[model samples]
Target chain A: MDVIRPGSLQDCLRILKTEHTIPIAGGTDLMVNLALNKISPDRIIDITGLQELKEISLSDNFLKIGALVTFSRLAGKEIAQYPCCNALREAAEKMGSPQIRNRATIGGNLVTGSSAGDGSVAILALDAQVELTGLDGIRKVPLSLFYSGYHQTAIHSDELLTAVYIPIRPGTSSFQKVGKRNALAIAVASLAIYSYIRDSHFEQIYIAIGSVAPTPIRAVKTDLFLQGQKITSGVIKEAARIIQDEIAPITDIRGTADYRRKLIANLLADQLQQLSESKN
Target chain B: MLSCKINGEEIHSEIPSDMRLIDFLREEMNLTGVKEGCSEGECGACTVLFNGDPVNSCIMLAIQAEGAEITTIEGIAKDGKLSDLQQAFIDHGAVQCGFCTPGMILAAQALLDKNPHPAEAEIRHAISGNLCRCTGYQAIVDAILAVSQRK
Candidate 1:
């Protein structure tokens, strides 16, 4: 196997456009698969050295996180202290362990396209936009449309994920994960909720779930049911029922399909009740 | 060929591009103090200080450390004398099987480097990745707390 360390983003783009290589940022996930012989790419492009992808800046309309920003940075006080990005911070802090977080990048986590990824679930709830850059140009795709299937994404072979843009919206957000252990365990089922409540009603809401589907997905039916609805136990219970039907979970080593369905419904109901009480 | 500062020494060698950092440390540099229990990032047995931050070396390519400073278990002691944290490990009987000691100490060291006087919860959080099946973690936690209190 050959490895190429590109010094700049332009150089990386050029290499990515011309070569048959796998771009490795943190290598927390990729290296594991490589060692297990699950993937055998002939060339590997080390993208961790790209300075442009290591930034986290708040713009007027969005909080732009660079692609190579490690989970440790997101879990740190610098990013976690931000009210708008707190759910994402919670997800980052709960993933793996300190060592894994230090080497795991948000970009890598999304690109892996794992349904068990906590970061992807939170990003989906945030209604974030992914920035993909190639030799031709750049395109921003919504997180909802980014996943095509299990372990597959809309990212092209020649394009590099440049940044993730999360809208700067004032909302109450929460992240909950049911992993086997507190640290270093893949989530059995996870949910992230971001809601904009006004006058004790849900003005806008987004809910994303993981490990209960082929890919981390938004609970579109549940979100639509809750939008513009009154903050009441009856409405919350109805929305929870809608969420149970929205997911297509599978029985795996982590959890059973029936258990996940029940967990999702209960988790969503609890989060909705909490949000309602707090906002009211 | 890559160049990196290991154990406070600037070393340049022709390491394989595909070699994991843990293998490079143990095989090429003879730094066997960095254990390879899991070979994956889960166990944290291969934990080392990469640019003053603890990371699982087994999951990292040796080429990735080209320009970074790496500190393995061998780097913690100075001039054949164990650091205060390492001495405390022995004093508290934190090394039962001794396999997880190096990684635990390095993990704790990374935490202390950032926060010298860490709380008990912080110490446990710092070494959460390094699992010691023998000592049940009380001794390890006590060892780290002792070092912090002494400082």
Candidate 2:
């Protein structure tokens, strides 16, 4: 139950590597896990107070989101710049409740690597990259490769996730999801679709779905099929079928795998129709 | 050891390292307004404003609150005068059993402080964390909105 408040990232890594430490950002997830007796670490590194880790900036090619940036901060009008990211914004807006969003962080959500994490699916759809800092220095990794499996991440105990980078995409995006209820609810099945249109045809399509797989997964088969294809009911149905086949949903308290598959098909078709209608 | 400001008073207590903020406020400070509905983060009954941000005190460690300013329901009124928001809650009949009111008030206060002119949707979003089984939340939202609409 040791609580260590390191003044800098370097010091944090030093103390973390020297002991059985867990970095706590917002403590939205870590606190709950600790209370449930699920995780026991000798030292808890409090990173929530680190000012350097709380910044939100944008570069020429990418948007950099600090590891400690709360969902409430990201939901601000300033950071929500792109259309696909709009879905991410909407998801952020619906995460937990206002209190939860104020404390729960983007880094915590990504680090938890839960398939049901609403923000995880949204960021995954944006093709975000994560920055890691340690004794060696800073290095970045694509977010897709960050999570190795359920409740697991490539992030080591000696490293700290500093920022998340999202490259700007050209297109309008929408997120449609079905949860048990409205607020503080995990998605039974959710879909994020970002498609760029060129002369009524999809030049590029980015689709990811969550709560239906071990991790938030992109509908790669559907994405490839939709690319360069005209928006039509037939194309949407075909892509929907491809998504149902691609994702490996499991039976959880939320819903059954068969139900989730059906949900994916319906949500994909609905969002694609919405994209088509919004075009005019 | 935890040292921080709670309810406008500087606190320095050698509490158990694993004591959560909710327990610290209730047992040490005797500020029982922060009720614990769910020990987990799902229920917002134990919500408190830490550094002007609404968070679940139940899920956070007491030591994690060190060096931070916390606002509880007891801190809402000054000089024995109930805040307009608190009065509005009474006026709108927002409390039934009165367990969730303190947290509800703090959550509403945090929202009003940030956005004084929040829309209806925003009002709902602000108190989404605080669960109210008695009022069904319409009265709660009305109370917050009524107070916010006042000047």
Q: Which 10 residues in a row give candidate 1 chain A its minimum summed lDDT?
A: A78-87
Deviation from native of the Cα of residue B114 in model 1, angstroms: 1.3
TM-score of chain A of each: 0.97, 0.96
Report per-candidate DockQ. 0.88, 0.74
Q: After superposition, how far is residue B46 of candidate 2 from its true place, in Å?
A: 0.8
Q: What are the RMSD figures for all models against the true structure?
A: 1.3, 1.8
| TM-score of chain B taken alone, every candidate | 0.98, 0.98
Candidate 2, chain A: TM-score against the reference:
0.96
Best by DockQ: 1
Range of the 10 consecutive residues with the lowest summed lDDT in candidate 2 chain B: B124-133
